[model samples]
Target: MKKARLWSLLEDGRVQCLVCERRCLIRPGAKGACGNYVNVGGELFHLGYGRLSALESRPIELKPLFHYWPNSTALTFSSYDCNFHCPWCQNYHLSFRMPDISQPVFSPEKLVELAVREGDEGLSASFNEPAVNFDFLVDVAEHASKRGLYFMLVTNGYFTEKALDALLRAGIDGWSISIKGCKGMQKPLGNIDFYVPFRNAKTIKERGGYVEIVYLVVTNTNDYEDCYRWIIEKHVTLLGVDTPLHINRYFPAYAWRKPPTPISKLLEIAEEAKKSGLRYVYIGNLHNPRYETTYCPKCGRPVIVRNNYRVVDWKLEKRDNEWKCKYCGYPVPIKGEYIPEKKWLGLM
Candidate 1:
């Protein structure tokens, strides 16, 4: 544990955690709303700092970031703790309940070294709220940036302005913000404002970082037609219609045991999203072979085809720093090139 950042002390013996939008005022020897911050003798201590809970290599597509670095691998790592307590959380074992197994501390330099050694083009913090490990993320990202590796985050996107600024200032290259439509949902302790995720995504983009939005359509909860339409409109107005939007399927997990999302529902929305003018739309967390592929918005040709997270086909060419479809003159919004198929065959 380290001395936490983005927090301040109180005169009456309480400390406020500014790590998230909740602004949780933690009392002595008590944890914050996120269950990660603690007040230890009038000082705010981050219980999750530098505690490496999981680490692995994955394609950027798995982050659901289809536009930036399509097939490149990123060395992703995350510690314990989250800003939200979603009952439908898939990684409850990692995010909700901190693992009882031993979690070792990894220094910023050590993490950067590992990423360089592993031959990753970038690094990502995922599996939980990356902001909970703010100090570590900033330091490690700064070091990694100097070593020619970029940084990305898969976050719930409910950060305070200070937290968001710290990340953008540290050179976060890309983001995937998950929007859970649980606005005004009651927790045992505090309530949540669901719109904060959109605000966080906007902040990242306004600060000039590439961003994509993911919405898990849960049946009988946030899967209404109007809700999807409103989000699509907002994405067009705020983030741009061309922004990559991932419509992921929800499955039963944790406390909420609803039926798995229907593939028919995914297709229905995919058609709606296309008609809604979203250039890059993907259906994730479930296999819908048709929707998983990226096509040219103008010519209607399949530009990138994938099986699972693996890219099986890429038909893009870079000219004068812009991506163009090889078949037609249509421009692709993707940022990086598809590495040789062989280079992407293995993480090494």
Candidate 2:
């Protein structure tokens, strides 16, 4: 366990955690709302700092980050628990529990070294909300930046402005932020402000970090047309139309087990997003290859072809510092170097 950051002491012998938007006021010997940080003698202590629950090498595509670095590998890691209490969380096994502090610790330097040793191009904190490990992430990102490797986070975007500023200063390269819908959905998710995610995404983009948004369509929950319109409008207005939007299909998991999201509904929303002038829209968690592939916005030609996370064909050419279509010469908004070869390294 390590000393936590972004926290302040309270007058009534309590401490407030400022890492995420929750602003949990933890009393002595008690845990925060996320169950990862504990108050020890009126001081805040991070129980999950440098302690990992899951670690493995995964494709950036698995992060659902198609535009940033296609077919590249990232050393992804996650700690236990989450600030949000989504009943239908697919990663319930990881998010529903607290960090096992009894287990061995993995230092930030060691994690960056392992990524370099394994020939990964970047590092990602995923599978669960990463805000609980904010201090550790900043350390790892600092080390990664020094070593010429990129660092990213797959988050629910519940972080406070202070935490987001620290991450930006640490050279965070990319983000795959999840948007669960607007204000009415906060009660089931620990009363978190729905606008926090969108706000942080805009801040990151304004600071020049790559970002992509993920909207998981749950059946009978946030699958309404108005909800989709809200997300699409926010994505365009805040981030811009060139930002890639991933509409994912949700399956029943954990407590709320209603039914799986229908494919027709997922497809319908994706189509609507495209008709609304989103340049890059993709469908995830479904086996339809056509939706997984990336197409040239102008020429309607496939620039990056993929079959279930593996890039099979790359038809774009780099010209004058931009990835352009071979047939139409339309510049695609692809960042970083395109890795031609890849190895499907399974979970460790």
- The best candidate in terms of TM-score: 2
Which pairs of residues clash in candidate 2, taking residues 3 or more apart in a chain or in different chains?
Answer: none
Model 2 CA deviation exceeding 4 Å by range? none
What lDDT tens digits, residue by residue, belong to model 1 across residues 194-250? 677777777777877889999898867777777677777777777877788899999
- Please report, in order, the local distance difference test score of every candidate based on alpha carbons: 0.81, 0.89
Q: Give model 2's TM-score versus the native structure.
A: 0.97
**All candidates: TM-score:** 0.93, 0.97
lDDT of 2: 0.89
